[model samples]
Target chain A: MKKVSIKDVAKEAGVSLTTVSQVLNDKRDRFTTDTIEKVLAAKQKLGYLPNKNAQQLRGSKTKLIGVLLPNLANPFFSTMMQSMDANKESDVDLFFLTAPEEDIEAGIMHLVERGMDGLIIAQMIKNPERLNNYLTTHRIPYVVLDQSDDHGFTDIVRTHETGGGELAARHLIELGHKQLTIVQPAHLTSNMNLRMEGFKHYCQSHNVATPKVIESTLSKAGGYAAVDDIIASHSTAVFATNDEMAIGIIRGLADKGWQVPQDVSIVGFDDIDIAQYMTPALTTVAQPIETIGEVALQLIMDKLDSTLTHRDQQSIVLPSELIVRATTARANLDNS
Target chain B: MKKVSIKDVAKEAGVSLTTVSQVLNDKRDRFTTDTIEKVLAAKQKLGYLPNKNAQQLRGSKTKLIGVLLPNLANPFFSTMMQSMDANKESDVDLFFLTAPEEDIEAGIMHLVERGMDGLIIAQMIKNPERLNNYLTTHRIPYVVLDQSDDHGFTDIVRTHETGGGELAARHLIELGHKQLTIVQPAHLTSNMNLRMEGFKHYCQSHNVATPKVIESTLSKAGGYAAVDDIIASHSTAVFATNDEMAIGIIRGLADKGWQVPQDVSIVGFDDIDIAQYMTPALTTVAQPIETIGEVALQLIMDKLDSTLTHRDQQSIVLPSELIVRATTARANLDNS
Candidate 1:
């Protein structure tokens, strides 16, 4: 059977083609209630199938939002995606794009070609100038979930990395641990930089000597290697920027006959899922990841609605609390 | 600027509207070469913007494939999704739909309404008659993954679950474990059924006492409870249907006075990425998850091409292999 078209509906209603198109697209404000009823009656009689695929492009407002995250394998972002879905009240379609650091440009191009009206990017690559260039060209409104203050060009949603650092540092300082170090990734991304800044601020405020800072990859192997320098310098506490590295440090320390919270008090960030399940539940700062995704989505929706126009470069810095699990405890002052 | 329409293109090319549409939708075989050239020239000259969203509806094909998986938090399925993207040779768009048991019906309907040409579903729930009913009603071509025999209904793909079970059973048996139990989900699916059958067969063929079976939720908590039961019953080895449960069992054992590989040798299936990174690396069976996705896509493409038909229900059974890791070890008979 031939599918019913707009022309058929117009002919049945004895109206102009434009009248049928307007009714189908929900632009009936231009027509009277009586005319809309006639068009609706004809559409129902003819079994006219409104073209959804066509409607996606016909309007300036597509009601489709695109989300570009690093990878779903990371539980942090995966849980955030779930939270974002749960917080939505409107019927908005979500398009998720995953790209590794190398192929981020292609990923951005995919969203642009798809004609996404708004974007939420949680990217961790160094020097995202290429990405910025594309956004500038496309003119798609977006929000950046960043770690450092370097995101001056985009609306940023900041995580309290510095607060988490100060919390961890103060805990150790109160326990009389003078020898300490901060473990982090080599790159100066916002996540790591904010954390380091927080740690430094705590030391300066407390009038303690500057702590040693160790840079390494954000992996278990890096954590394992950083322990060697820590032991050599007789540091009593280690603050890892992320939980994965902290877990690795614990494993490495244990292998070398060092007991957690007994010889070295360790603190990690991001309170990852597996952290609680670990043997010595990590003492970490819990970042509210779900809030980030939810607020980001709301921000984009506001921009799409034309109520928001890059006003004040709003940055929401959610509070982070120190969750002192078994990994951190009273420092043993006799170690020296 | 007002969006250009097909009517404008037709008038510019001095041709009928249908002729211009045919050329745009790649139905050029029915038109003359000169006519095709004229339409192409007119499109380029007028800067004709063929509304992709509308064109998808008027055109015969959408070039969009929908993939439905159980959950993204599971590393196994996430890895499958990642690899599937890397292997796509064409510009096929992938739309991901997550089907929790409660929302599976609604999810299927949503995908159908979105105009997905083909589907690849991960059958996590039993009794797919409702799913089958939906497919039948829509007449949409689809392939099932991680499920039992095709039952002569649809294109199906599966891992050699039975073979994997037998290999795991043999490994445990050779290590001198006579008392064993297989832990799986509460309800039986085809994949779970096959794995259990293979395990029981191995025990029977070796003239060992019939092995015990435990059915619980396929979760960490379930694995934890299963571990307590196995210990109380004095079972020396346990085989979990998936990696998450196996890891749970390991943790449970540790919580008690039992050590992994020393007290209980455990085996799991679907060697997800985290399986290798576990504290005591997991020994389990590995499935070609991404290959299944790629194959499922190929099946749908074939159906679209009309090269394949419903006359024969095509099935693809991929192989599984055993990975030796720290989780399993030679059983000690002193405890027995």
Candidate 2:
């Protein structure tokens, strides 16, 4: 099959190159309505595919948005990406960049070099100085989602992470679990720190003793390690910052023949898809993942349209609810 | 914050517009190597960004490969995408398209419209006629992975799916299980069909009775639903086509007070990351996910280089290994 070109499209439409170019780029002000209609008819007749790359180079919006996610395998971020991909069909297409925390710079540069019009970045790097420099220097339109803090740029979307922490603590306290421990990732961030702070504050306000806070990896192995720490401390309840770690704690406990909610109540954050379906139907805080994606995309669109800017920095804190599943219950007197 | 153009780059490089264009498009064969170097140096010095879209229009290659995966949240596929992204770093970048079986055409057209130079598709669709049509019509360079039956389109990379199925069945049979069941997705594809065939074939050859087979979704919910069917049939052993579904099945069985291996043995495929961390450390067949990703990307590279064509329909099936974990055990005659 012969490849169709701008000349073929113009010839079929009975229009000049400039007129067809204007119509293809939607520069309708430069072309008459009749010319636009003729070009459309010819485009359909010849099945002419417009050169998208050329149009993008000419400063025509590609309607393609790039999202740089941390890990697509992680259900939390993957679910968010899925929602954005499904919901942003009317005006924009989405491309994704997946980077581990260690490869943040490479991921950022990948999208930047691709000539993406807008970006939605959800990564937690140890330092945002490079990212900040890049964002500030380029002034590319962007929205940051679920980051620990502002890198002094763009609109931000966040959950009420601290609220979720408080709810987890309060739930354990209400269940008559006094001795508590917070299991967290080894590398602390403002995000994890805030949750820990909220949990501590809740316990203090309720006249309960400050719970022991143990730092571990946010992975299953980390949860397994937390088990030994819990056993050593003889804590009645363990609060994991994320559902993965929380479930890991459950698995670790089961391996040790320590029953969940009976010997030790476990609470986790980020009610991922598998949380509810876990054997104990994990007791955790549900983050509004889909809503977060929708809101973040909207914020990016607004920024691209010049409706929002860095000054706006719209930090949205969606409510987090504690869902009591089989993981948490009244403290067992046997262990106490 | 004005946008920079090729003319600006040429002026900075002290070269003619045509020379700059040639250098930018890597048409350096027409010019002296020294002249090409000078233009490139000037481009970097001036931070001159090439208009990728415009260059893509004039060039035969987009330097963009599209990867159409089934689900981003599935660890198996997500990890594959991650590794592919890592390996495809020398000038070729990736665009991602994800669609369900029903949305295959939309996905194909989406990638086509974006001018993808080639594609690496993991089409888990039941009926691939639409998928076959789009790839054929466009003569799109492609490499299909994980799906069964090469649609006679070359550049295919598949794991030993049937062999994996056979291994799962033999594993159960060796454990003295006579009655078994296999749970697969509701929408059956060649992938599932082949797996079922492998299982049935092994059962027949070994004089083991063919067990019950239930079709369910590839999700945790589907696994949950298939449990009642397994329970009703009183199968001593079950095989889940994928690890996620198997995890779901285990969860469902535990919910029904059925102890794994003691009363029934469960096995799953696609030893995903979470497989080792499952409560019973899922006994399953492990596909070489990283190798599949690398091979698929290499195949796409082959297609882009015109070293392979659709008529070749070369299929590469990597072997799978059975990893025995805590999930499967010798059938307990005491239950009988």
Candidate 3:
């Protein structure tokens, strides 16, 4: 029941204690491949885990990064988390925390208290200035992702929200649909608001009547509950802010005896995994989720390694593409 | 920039340091409600966060729990995590780690090394015996959730896998579907194998021909890829082990010019949030994810509090139910 120590690994590998420590701490560049392999094998054989706290006390890197996300039940966020987890370096460990709006501050504090070398914040922060100040004061390297507002003091990675919205609107408008409706959550984040703005801008510029807007929660249930309103609006085409809502709307339409792309066409945002698997493969604005994850992680790592300084404040805006699928079609102008 | 200390809170609240410590550590039963409120308000005003490591050094609870899930992309697991996170006590913080099959051991070590008071593991552990020994030796309280195999030494909470499979089989049989198929992953876990066994058992008992089995990865893409094989099997009814695959199967069938419930009836397991939102409102076996998460957290808390000893080894199995939705219907024997 005795705890295995670096000494045991050193003895087992017939190496010095310094060699064992160096290998375990990821300072193996100076060591030959055979020696490094031997140390790792010895450590594995002895089942030795370098305690993060102990390592911190010894002034070595914990090699741990913390990520704060809005929701995991939503496939978009979960898939992003999965991609980051998959792409992170093997020696670096990630701790994930899901924080609804009210919990963002507390969640950030929890990760900070854990002494993470860096952080990735994907949720909306109520006070970006205050958060930047806090993180800077604590000397913690961090990056912001998916938040539409300029973080002012941190590197930001996000998709072109406005372009995404315009793409959805243009597709539906091009289908000869004069009556259009957009579904979104009652409480709008900056990113969601930008999408709405872009949609409105596109419609106004095209000299088409402004689309009717329906407010609902940002979830499947929200879209389901908005079905009655959608029907009453008499819109021939609908643009849902996210694929989850679109899926719910599609089901709701079917339940009410309305057919997709025949009675109504639906365009959704965020081409999450299940979007394509829906009955009439949803036409959506495809955000490069995998690329975003990679960029965000790399940004954080650069900061952690002192390659990207705090003042750099890099902003990378990735493009969103419109994916044409079965759900969208020519409007039934004869019925109109 | 000075760190907030207990003394600062004590001065702000006009209470002694001992009172502040006791209140913050959940030992406030002896204090009046007024005193507890004042201490909490003072702590909030000063933004004082107790250093967990410092408290641990003083022999106080760290109030941290670690959860290991197989995959966050799976709605079933993600929803369970969300439930547990929502239901945990305010003072308790949960750290989440997603570990695929190969990373389970390393994930456990990482959490344990961080000195978490308790652990909830929802993923499959290859060497439960070794894990049990290691945890016991370290005096860490832990519980296994959703793992089908019995651990000789830890508490377990899981759904009735066999009963779930039986429910699926019974529904299809009652619908008069003679050609049945059960789609599962290529590599079966003990729990998945149990589901298949119960499905076959029900078919045998009913004197129906042995149902055909199709192997695919446990994902939407996997199900979509297996569509040709499923069609070749000529199954009048299909039972997918999870909702993700069932969704893909439905989409694939649509692509192949087949109609659900008219040409084939499909039932899925783990009625995830999107199940009811599917075009046909997928008929699925529902696992009470919220209940399971609650029970699992409660068990881990009980152990941490010393109310449930390691020797107790409680095995709580919850039931699964079949929800009949639009995707299932009576077989059209004439088409055959």
Candidate with the greatest DockQ versus the true structure: 2
Residue by residue across B1-336, what tens digits does model 2's lDDT show?
A: 234567777887788989998788767888988788888987776566665655566563547888887777778887888788778755787888777667776777777777777778787645566666555555566777786357664567877777888999999999999988889876666777787788889999999998787888888888988988888877889999888899889998898999897888999888887787677778989999988999999877876664333435467879989999999999886654
Off by over 4 Å in 2: A1-48, A58-61, A100-106, A125-139, A306-313, A332-336, B1-49, B56-62, B124-139, B306-314, B332-336
TM-score order, best first, reads: 3, 2, 1
lDDT of 1 by residue, B109-215 (tens): 67765666677788554557766766665567777888533565788888888898899899999888999888888776778788888988999999877788887
| TM-scores of chain B, in order | 0.80, 0.82, 0.84
**iRMSD for every model:** 5.2, 3.4, 5.0
Name the TM-score of chain A in model 3. 0.85
Docking class of 3: acceptable
lDDT of 1: 0.75
Query: What is the descending DockQ order?
Result: 2, 3, 1
All candidates: TM-score: 0.76, 0.83, 0.85
lDDT of prediction 3: 0.84
